[model samples]
Target: MSETVPTPPSPTTRRQLLARTGAAGIGIAFSGALSELFTGTAAAGNLGHGGYGPLVPDPDGLLDLPKGFRYRVLSREGDPLRSGEGPVPSNHDGMAAFAGRHGRVHLVRNHENRATGRVPVPVIEGLTYDPEGKGGCTALTLDHRGSVLSERVAIAGTAVNCAGGPTPWDTWLTCEETEDKAGTNGYTKDHGFIFEVDGADPRRTGAVPLTAMGRFQHEAIAVDPKRGVVYETEDAFDRPFGLFYRFLPRKPLGGTGSLRAGGRLQAMRVPGVPDLSSIRETGARFDGIEWVDVPDPLAAGTPIRFQDFGPRGITHAQKLEGCYWGGRSVYFVSSYARSSEGSAGDHYGQIWRYDPDRRRLTLVIVFGPDTDVRLPGESPDNICLAPGGGLMVCEDGGGAQHVYGVTRRGEVYAVARNRQNVGTPEDPEWGEFAGVAFSPDGDTMYVNCYAPGTTFAVTGPWRG
Candidate 1:
């Protein structure tokens, strides 16, 4: 199978990628040469000292950031829980940051919970896989000036968990978003999968699922630590849309990174784009890409992206959620698209970019259903890859919940907002920003609010 032919985007890089991609089709373009090369200058009058400049408004009103930045909530769902077990476990959502013991900084987080009694933890029997499934993962630690120093639970039960990724042998793949199964809705076991969480012994972590990594509904995951490949993401919000996976890993990661020693679960095909909901424009490229095998990566009820993998074609992405792996390519996120939800129509967010050395798959940023334009979030779900370079998104749509930051010349900056406010006086600060990581010496910048779950860090000056 060597018909290799993928080298053609060089008329000066396709005119600098058509002068930084934007405006291809699908009724909504944003104008001004794609909003001044990708949504920068959108709203945010003053506060740019590189970034983190004009936010300061949090007198304990939750988070606002900017001005020497300064956050550090560390952990807080129900609070307490410093390994004494109990409490500190709510929605939280995707997170990752490693390196601890002396230098400190472990993180790990992710609760997202999918029901079944709501919240409760302390079931570390043999590192639980589904005590009844309320979701799991905690491990805090911190300190190197970020504060906090203990908060445990690591892996347990496992259900909605949500976004995860950070493992070039450091561990923390989390996922689960929900395929439910097992005794139906009451769940005895059999939730959408992908579990591995150790981050250097987060309570001996091990609920093992990796079920060949497929299940559907999983959300975020991105790890190509030089070809160990794992890129998953699927929020699937209705009408057959949600795919973009890639597991590969039969054996390539040497030591104790452990992908459970099972792999091969592809899905991602843009060949001639049959019906990926018509590829909702924005920069819309989709060069070549191909990958199809996925008979049933533990589907149990069928949903390997609607499986059929025969002539090899599969494409979905409407709510593919977050995914990140910087430069060498892999930066997914298709958070919104709506033909009333069946997609291929009313998009509100996009951002693709795959490129594994020309296998191609581009669609760099799109968001049409104006939230008052100039880019300030609409549904851009959890993503992270901005140690000053590009992407940082996280704003599950709806209002006053930012954490944006696009730049790599694509502009868009509003970094951190969420003024956390729940009920009473009729709700307003609608918390959304979930797990926006960056702290392996990239200073500090952990996120997460997802409904009173909290866990900040922030720091200052980061622009690249």
Candidate 2:
């Protein structure tokens, strides 16, 4: 928070803040003007690099772990599996890490693959592995130093598990990134459901889909035990503007693993604003967001029904993707989906925060809609919070894909460049930032890249 920072005269007046941020970096502007605006005081804003800087690719390529930090590779695609199931399958995305006694840790990670003709490996234990098809969910045992002590294919015989979330009970909720027909031979598994895996439970069943979590092309999920609600994001690429969903479990409790039964599935409908017609897609930029509870969230289907009486169906230009929990609130992010605001492009993506208490949604940061901080054609696939109290966004599109960390006040920086990971040193290609998870202590981070993708355990100090 510096004295030179500019303050907007009014909420409608954004230029002063914009200029300061773009020209002066986030540090001075946020602390100076931002603090004053939010608290009527000018203090050092933790916005700018706070010491953290721009995103880096092949982190080892240009930089070393920050002071007091270290990292290791816990697992990567093509790595050998201990279960004699063969090499680790392709597409490592959405993951969770938890502590276990005896110097061991439980991990449940996802693989974005459809049930191929055969799934020799039970990604994890306790899975039906329907002959229809299976391709997702793997559980493992690891050390803090990033070594796989003993690994098991947790769940198998599923389809495209793109991204999922960590539960309070130390389990992983793997979500389907697409909706496939269950009747088809290779597509027997039903469309869109969240599966659970127990990293510590060696006897744990392979992987079992949480039919209670509902069915749809689920991208990610965020759980709130207090509310008995499980929030999820959808990646409906075939149908633009992915929807935001929530599962109101029939029962909400803190008994650890008691949430796998079933619940009501509801999609978010921005109140007051009507649904966007197909015509809105081509010219869409960003959806003017105003999230309201859907009436009867359980009665969700194409011809919708509800409890809150909100709008029905997905809006234009908002393929909902990526999510995280923060400030007693839940966040939902968007990508590629067109919006009327011109903010949905590779160059820029938007992050929206949903306050459960207020039952309201607000826009905290808007990036890339302009020339300055935009990615060439970046598709924000998924995201999680960083130890630095910021967000790490996974760029899942194009050749220059990378991970971006954004400060709470909206200063975006690239802490890691993944394009070169596992690629020929001289020939690099941008890949998808599929899965991300931080250790319980927030001292380390594990990033999984898709395609010849490698998972890197990165540890560092929270500079800001």
Candidate 3:
């Protein structure tokens, strides 16, 4: 199979696209009318203070942030929940915040637990999908002051609940990053699917997997509000990398439970680009992109990436992690790639923005191999567009872990650092940051520490 690489867009056309989309070169596009979020925000290069200034060491030795910022521990592993079911689960990963009644905050959090963990999501009657599966989601209700009012099990009986995305109709899509079958791992049913959780009403969240969305090593997803199309990422790091997918649902914007109706899953095909990691240029653009229908979304035997796509094979990327919908484009992350791992090239990370309107994919940001491991631009995992503009990226790399901020100009700065020492004082260990989100009013930020399984509500003077 072969594909012809199209010529790059002209400079004038690139400039016009950027101007029309308000894409600030950093892959930062105004999400709808969110341009006001960056009104007075300083450019990444011009910020002598480095975004919000230097991070001040925390007295609690947990999370360090800029001066004037404060964080509250909303929930932790083994912490008893208000629902009286059991303790909070471990390995907090992807999360989303929603508006709650009476100015409260509703958060749906994922517990990325596999077969075993420090604490597993307790199985409830209607919420339990498989009694043996040890991963699921939890819902928390917090007051406006960042105080946890209630916490309960949203869904249970799922495996490897990794990163997921929020829906347009106010629901959380929790994905299982596993392909374990029922009989292989002491299971009863097939795994590898996406489940919808209702943060507002836990009872309404029946633990049902959207099978039509495809079954593979699922990662994060981005939902296009205009068309109700779901763009998903797969984290399969084997010989052949995972393919980016988009599901065209039978019912668009049909609110909750609509996705369960079914959809057609398709893989992205970027002409001559077989491996995305080979494209190192920051502004490299690929036009005339196409989507190939997956032979089998269920993956009854062969995985989607391994499945045949005819003469032109599907394009794949290494470590396709975070995904989010911004303006008219869908931004997805490739955490890192290595030649030793069968990649075409090597790089610290790359962020690609796909414009559905133009059927174009642009490499907006590329973290070179020389990026400082201690810095913010290395191996970005879960990501969310900040309410105050720019982006909040969770680091999942070697050395120190931090929640970094990226401006429209592509400048990187530290927002919060994980200082919690889970190991001995002599050999300290830090957990990666995951599930970075913001409240509806944009006053509070919610993030999680994947290790000790801690959720934090951070408040401070956010840049407007």
Candidate 4:
């Protein structure tokens, strides 16, 4: 049931990463970002000294970052889009940056809304899936100076567009975090599916759901470029939790529309381990992983997690959130687990690395229950490899939200703080940070504030 996989001898080791990145810290190295974070470097400690120094308070009372760093509001909920269709939607969750033509960067952002929001995604013709569904994605084109050139509705009429992954061919997979079906909660069509959104060109981002990818409380996904296999995570926490999934696309990497051809949806299973939260120790590994086919990927009746998976049931995890591909392995996150919530175990947070080549899943980082709620070590959501090295984790826990950075030594440092107080002066409301990603060139960092729905472009001397 429990095993320790031998660490591969490579630059992935913590000692090697420290040597490469240097103990004092250098500039951001995009190539070794993920390797530095997972390799022994994610031991969970607040090294308040090394990361870009201390965060300087913002005069505008919006976002606080280190000295010399500044942020600009790129978009906000109710802001009018360039298409003249409607204003921006609310709850900007997961986002990805891509290279664009003529020295521009395209950003595909998810709007995590449901039936009602402050500003709903406009049900535009050709882009809307269901007229009743109000969650979708927006595409923004930024110039070299990180200025928004144009903004348009990429996909619309979806529900709970939570977090999704970017494709190898420069596309974004926007996922619906809800399992609402027709006649439920005013949904005109069945929800809970992945829709491909093209950041560069909104015309290509048809609001068609990839039904073959399984229908459940979809959270996030990571596509393996080598095998053309897509790794997905379910965030259902009602009773049975959620299962880790993989979608084998029939046409691999053909282009943006390749996944529409249909594929096989399967769930992961570990011989003896049923719930992933049961594993507590860091560096814990499970080998010989198995995949079981889901009889109903559409989940027209029973949800995927409750469905039978034979004698050996599928493995499930609590609050499986952020997912991304790094260093030939797929990294997924369990935001937090609590026994009172029906989880097998309890933890502040955990990051797991799954190696397809070795067929192994290792717990690289584990946040203890005693982790400071105000710190960056707990409730990590919407993670991405920072262009400046290490991992950029968005804190979704209690108190003031922040975008924290984990160095190559597993040391946690505050990268940016959410200073926006949405509530009154007495009881201030801080929104959780989401969609933390860097530009392809690594010059600018893009993140979102979930509550008021604001996107910020952060830039500074990242070569600390």
Candidate 5:
């Protein structure tokens, strides 16, 4: 991994530039130590000023929230589901909340179960994409008060359904994070495809794969509601690195908001940046970035990221994980670039903002190695913009795991902490927070604990 630091973006005023960049609403909170490391002056201390000062330890030893905040365990693994076919699955990764009937919110969540694990959703003849595959999505309806009304297996028979984005027309696009081939591993159909599930009608929903989107290990996606373009990220950890993609819907979402009609897929390419290793600094920005059409949208064997597509100039990241569409920019995370284990690249984490209007990509936040255990560095996985303000990041790094909050002013704070210790006494109270999203009303926030598979709905004074 190279430590090359290219020239930073033109010296623009931080407030003037970042505030108007539409990143203020991004869900990416860092530690207070990161704030002091990046910026010279620290406006806020360990926890942001406006946020609830510090997290009060939970009595249940599950989730620790602020003084005025409390969380309810909405769903857990092995619990009886409304579908009656199976119980709630483990490893809840990515999720989205949609407006439901009678002022309720419908949450479509992905189960990141691999082929070897038990199938989360039952195999229906017409609905199952691959019967042997053990990954899919589940839907839960929550009342206006943030309580779970009902839970059901929404989609089933997919392989490693990891992370995906919600459609403006009310639907969930679940992606498979595996490239497992068919006829192998007892799979009758190929894996590594994005499936669309109706958020409202999960019971009768049709599980259809959007093959036009390239087949790869997809992590997360963000849809541009205005242009109807969908931005996707891949969790590629191999040599070549993963390419960021955007799908241009051919007909856009009509009354149905279905992506089944198919579309063209393109990869992002930084023209001037010769190779993908030029971006090394915290605030590096590239101008006039372009997109190249992927040669084969549904190509197998070789993924579009590594395939010899055109100039092969698509900028690749170590592990592109979470992505969310902000007011005008697409904020994406590169989960730890330049690994110590020699996987590839440098830096622990980076948040890049793609400005479609300026046709440029700006590096907003970068996480380097920090020695402070109380306020250590973080590797953010699944991220989303908080309704109150700033970004809430799910920490996947070492030490105590937390949902850190990054304010618009660049201040970092810990929003919530995980305190789960089940396996053994040696096993620390550590669990990664994923699929963090707030309800439409902005009063309730929903997140998941990856291991024991617990979904929590936290209601509190969001503005505080």
Candidate 6:
């Protein structure tokens, strides 16, 4: 790639950017030892800290948490649980951390599958799903040392258990991002909705589905403390374009974690046409502050469609997937374009930010077809804020994808190349480590993915 990413007012070709070497200009310099290891396989099987701290559970060994943090293999892809009450499903998506009994921690992890009746033989009540993404979620409890105390099946019969956010009251807001029938969706009867998982006490109750979050193709979950509103992203751009929304619980949060009997769901609308100039024009900028009220969020033809960023809008939108809150901002990413529809503005990928203070949204990083000479345009998937700040984008796009980072000043660098050492263009698994998380202290990091389906931890001093 290019040595120094153009600061401004300069048109650079993709080739120049991909020509960058061992250590391109991303601020600090790489040591001689570190430089040689940058593009090699040795680092893949070892701890990689990139521009931050060390990665725990060295790739050479098994999954083990670093010193300060702990981990437990709650459930594996093909593992059976709960006396075979149900078969363990695959594709674990979103997860959250909460305070358990006497200071222990609890996690409500999601499984993304649309299969049904494919249960792994020998049924387990609260431990299995329809296997075909028929909508299911799980809960696991662990102590401070990373030892899993117990595991249980929360709720079954939900599809595409995509990513979700944690609520203020120590509960996970899991979302079913896909329609139940897959044919005719966008209604309450189907699978599109957000539910709550109470991790404190099992005696408190099992899984309780919350339908109040709406029935559109759900994605990430975010909460706005300023207004006691829970923000959500929609991957459902059937006709009018996907939407962003907020749910105001009708009853206080102490309710029975049921969406059907809860608050109101409202879609978001930017006040005035948001000025995306900060990204497009480079200089002809505006704060990008805009707001839209749902008005009648429950009505299918409600006025929520006004939120799309367009002359009203454009072709099918970039399906927004992951989202989280940090430093007073709610961040999210848009997946690539649909093949059915042609040139999606030839967009590689972009990350957008929403500021609660100014009540606006802005597109930040634009990783185009110049990411790497090995393979261009890798689909950027979910993302998490780094402990040292910035973002760790999980690249799911094809060939030679890496977990890359972007600074507020517009600098980008690869933290670790996810491609294994096997060496081959047809590498069956180039990048599967999609989900990334940090310990409470932000000193340790963990990552997991679908291919071969494994989780990793890396520990060390990564902050500048």
The digit string of per-residue lDDT tens for model 6 on 228-322 reads 56778776544344666667766545545534457866555444332121133112223644334454443344324443334544222446667
Q: Which candidate, 1 or 5, would have the higher TM-score against the true structure?
A: 5
**Candidate 4 accuracy as TM-score:** 0.89
lDDT of each: 0.69, 0.56, 0.81, 0.80, 0.73, 0.51
Candidate 2 yields a Cα-based lDDT of 0.56
Clashing pairs in 3: none
Candidate order by lDDT, decreasing, is: 3, 4, 5, 1, 2, 6
**TM-score of each model, in listed order:** 0.35, 0.75, 0.90, 0.89, 0.86, 0.70
Q: Tell how far residue 289 is off in model 4, in angstroms.
A: 0.6
Give Cα distance to truth, residue 426, candidate 3, Å. 3.6
Residue range 1-464, candidate 4, lDDT tens digits: 00001221222233233423334423221111234254222332333455778788888888999888989999988878887988888888899999987779999999988786668899888999999988899999999878899999999999888899999999999898888899988998999999999888777767788999888888899989899899999988567998899999999786867999998999999879989999887777889999899989999889999999997778888889999988689989988777777889877678888899999988878763212333455667889876544678997765567898876565567899888877766545577889988888777899998878999999887642
Q: Among all windows of ten consecutive residues in candidate 5, which has the lowest summed lDDT?
A: 1-10
TM-score of 1: 0.35
Error of 1 at 168 (Å): 38
Weakest ten-residue segment in model 3 by summed lDDT: 1-10
Residue 373 in candidate 4, Cα distance off native in Å: 5.6
Which has the higher lDDT value, candidate number 4 or candidate number 5? 4
Q: What is the lDDT of residue 173 in candidate 4?
A: 91
Supply the global lDDT for candidate 4. Answer: 0.80
lDDT of 3 by residue, 198-254 (tens): 998877869888999999999999999999999999998586988899999999786
Candidate 5 lDDT (Cα, 0 to 1):
0.73
TM-score of candidate 3 against the unseen true structure: 0.90
